[model samples]
Target: MSSIAEQDLADRRARAIQQLLHTPLLHRDTPSFDTIATSEQWLKEWFLRTCGWILIVDYRRGMARLRKVTGWIDSTHPQRSLRTGKSTFTIRKYVTFCLTAAALGEHGRSRISLQDIAVAVSDLSVRAKVSPFTDLDHKDRQALVDVLMLLSALRVVTELDRTGRDYSVDPTGNVLYEIDERRLGQLLVAPLPPARCSTWQQMAADPHPQPSSGAPLDAHRLRQHLMRRLLDQPLCYLSDLPDDDAAAVSDHTEHITQWLSEAGLALEIRADAWMVVNRRAGTARSLRDGSNVSNCALLVLPQLTAQPSGWISATHLATLVDELLDEYPWWARSLRNDRNRADAVATVLRSFDLIRPQSDGWRIMPAAWRWAARVDPACLPPSSSPIPTQPAQDDLFSVEPTHQ
Candidate 1:
């Protein structure tokens, strides 16, 4: 690209970002540097908690991206291990694409279709660049299906959504298996797929967490309401806040702003005061005016809970995560009882408004861990009293909660 063209693209991106920020209040125009630092730190910690040590690290960015690695034994596994280019940072080569495509399909974190891999790798010879078989153009899908078969045979992965609902047709006239993610960790060597948690179910079971609806309307109640409100959209401004809201936030505005800012929610700086909104709606909110905060807040749940403004703070967050971890021991595989681990967990909990920080400890926010427990009773520790219902009301990643 020419320098002028590159500059134009950069300028366009800058304009787009500025426009995105415009959706925030004037005071919320920019994040305080502390929040930025906290977010970056939290992202890194989140990856490490799940990936262990082999994650891709960016020292400059202080972050890492994880790759799923499957470990299966076969007469072929040994052979491939001995041979050149058996595994890679990516799914590789043309001839090997039969296996490669399946690995990408079933195990890939990114939602790459078989054809997405085939087109990108067709011309290259390296493990990183080889394409799937493309003869007769449409026949490549059998190769992908064959690859999944190989994976199944090798125990690298298994197919889920067995109704065969997620298949994509390969160019070669064959229908390929859409790789299932639930049991993907069964394919890996050391690290495993992070277990998905059901927030609603857990909340439903928690003695500490109150009802999903109807509350004394304390800080916790406020957070629960906020999370529920976000089901419809991103944020709610304080000035325009509902009077009937029993769930008010921290009495102090500055601390509340800092806490939400540290967590995933951000405050838009307006001419008068800052504002807060759900981060997922960050993209949408970025495009609209601050007037949309209420709508967005109302949009996020019962799909996902929103953190009330009352519960905010990096320090308090650390403790809340510790408590949640204590309550849910199954995820203990991912949690270590160390300080950094605590810090990382706190940051994410903070993002979701599950907790707020005090000078020395975390204060559990209005959100409930029982939600996940209620949704997935199997998640409770074996010794604990059995929950009466299935906790998994919906898939973790899908938009099922929206329909709720």
Candidate 2:
């Protein structure tokens, strides 16, 4: 094959993997079809080897799904709003989302008008004894529309005429949509049916049986799995692995780097850490640090690193966050007075494996020290000596975002 041809093939493969990591689900209407169609098979095998499961590609429906399975615990991240800053959602919104889904399922028709959906949603909410939107203000109705827009984005309901915003403005009738039944089912990608588990705690527990210690470990397979994870995830900690696997990964750092290079990815290896620096194949990254929660994480990272024992309790961390909020009230106004600040921060930390909840409190992970190093004064440009006081409108989770 020509050199250019090989590079093109490699670029396509990298894009496929990147999309799978970034998007919770991929549908045909989106531009990701190119990657999903050309590289589906390769992605399926790669995910199976790395994550212990395969991708679900519904060719007839034009969908590619990836079920995020972590240690058999089935708590996926909350469905965040694409437009909302830090994607905040109230419990009412959550309940409304489920009720709307049930309403759609019971509607039985492929097409429904927005007015009809509103009536259905109102009826469902009343049946559940939740607050009715019969007397909703502009903001409250917008929240309901946000949930519907999220569903539209996921291809659960195809807007036939009017947009979600229009529905929010006046949900009396007019907006039409066609329901994608398969896509609705795709939204919940749990490994087991809800009937099998009763409580959230039971669902959170590892469902798989532990492997026997006497079973033979395939050295090559172990190395392959480690390499795939190093490339796929933001970071892989030794503390999360078995002793033998951890030792094997640490010993084969050089081989892993070489393998990454062959696949056109740059690697950064440390004593107790490894990460992908860049992709030479020019594929876009999936993990981005541009949310309000992420900004909070960055602001508090230096304080966490300065601790003598390199550990801090969740209570202390929350106190630190309170201090930061007081110092910069306009920074993340969404979280400043919000009661869920701790939960939001914990969610961000858990996503990056930056902290662990122990008997005493949360333990800072080694990989998070990189954030501290990044904030060093020496790393700043001469013109930008001090952190700017005037927050940019483009700042992630900014109080007044320039873009809606």
Most TM-score-accurate candidate: 2
Model 1 C-alpha lDDT per residue in residues 1-404, reported as the tens digit of each score: 99998665434333322222332111122332223233434434432332222333333422222332222111211122212222211232225544464446434563444445454334332443544344344334444444445555443334432432323342432233344343233333232232333443432232333346644455544554443233223333343344445224434334444434433455443321223544433333321232222112111121233333333345444444455455445544434344565454444444444334665655543332323323433334564633333334323223212100
Candidate 1 TM-score, C-alpha based: 0.24
Query: All candidates' TM-scores?
Result: 0.24, 0.66
Best by lDDT: 2
Q: After superposition, how far is residue 31 of candidate 1 from its true place, in Å?
A: 16
Summing lDDT over every window of 10 consecutive residues in candidate 2, give the lowest-scoring window: 395-404
RMSD of each: 22.6, 8.7
Model 2 lDDT vs. the true structure?
Answer: 0.65
lDDT of 2 at 173: 35
